[model samples]
Target: MNPDATTTGADAIDEAIASGNDFDGSPIPQAKLGLYHQVMGLEAGRQRSGVSNTMRSRIVRIGAKHIPQAELNQMLVDADFAPLKDKEIAFYYSGK
Candidate 1:
């Protein structure tokens, strides 16, 4: 895939959760939550810049080879909550 393509972190995570595969439709391993986290975290960090081509490519290859549907779904939920939890903690601390 073109590195220049506009692929956001949310886009990648959503695709992984919804499709159980990478954007190219290759299956992702459920065990590679770390990879997903890294990719998603990068996306979150950038906010608007999106996933870099290098990271996107890595995610595609790793996901295609490893993740399963059910695990991917759970990971998706975890991934979704992680940022929220972080925000909650931040807000809590800020009020102190």
Candidate 2:
């Protein structure tokens, strides 16, 4: 599977926020959380399929570019959002 073709978890969160849907006071919408799970599942599948860290980094970079550092940090802090792995965080900040 091509990791590049898959939307990153960050992108999903961004889209969810952009949708203007009510979240019942939650920072993230259910749809966005679902998409984040899906993206992580795809990443795990890619790992199982032997995708390299280099590729993962590239994918993270691409997604991170779409979001500002402050917003990304806020998303990371949201209780409803899954935190990214350290390497993914590193990759994201590296691209910022």
Candidate 3:
């Protein structure tokens, strides 16, 4: 597996995700949004392979750039995710 592609632990996952204003709160930077998209895309593939929720968040936090890991987690939680599952999360990244 690619070093950039891996999973994390539970607490770490929860720490990265946000829990306010739906989807990491508004006002996401465009460039970071793009990075979030890329990181998430990679995460989606890993989710398929059985990585833990925390692991997923950690990977994006340490390896990728877009969408701050905390925000991503917050977004996921906002979307009603209590744990990591093999499902895609949506982030309407506006180029603001």
Please report the candidate that would top lDDT against the real structure. 2
- Model 3, 1-96: lDDT tens digits are 222422355443333332211233344466765687689879777735344656555544443245654576676566565532333232222222
Q: For each candidate, C-alpha RMSD in Å?
A: 16.8, 14.6, 17.8
2 or 3, greater by lDDT: 2
Clashes of 1: 7
Order of the predicted models by TM-score, top scorer first:
2, 3, 1
Among these predictions, the greatest TM-score belongs to 2
Tens digits of per-residue lDDT, candidate 1, 1-96, equal: 333433565476565655556656566677675687788888777745334544444443354345653453355456542222344334333343
Q: Which sequence of candidate numbers ranks them by lDDT, best first?
A: 2, 1, 3
Clashing pairs in 2: none
Name model 3 segments beyond 4 Å from true.
1-26, 47-96
List the global CA lDDT of all models.
Answer: 0.50, 0.56, 0.47
Candidates in order, TM-scores: namely: 0.23, 0.29, 0.25
lDDT of 1 at 11: 70
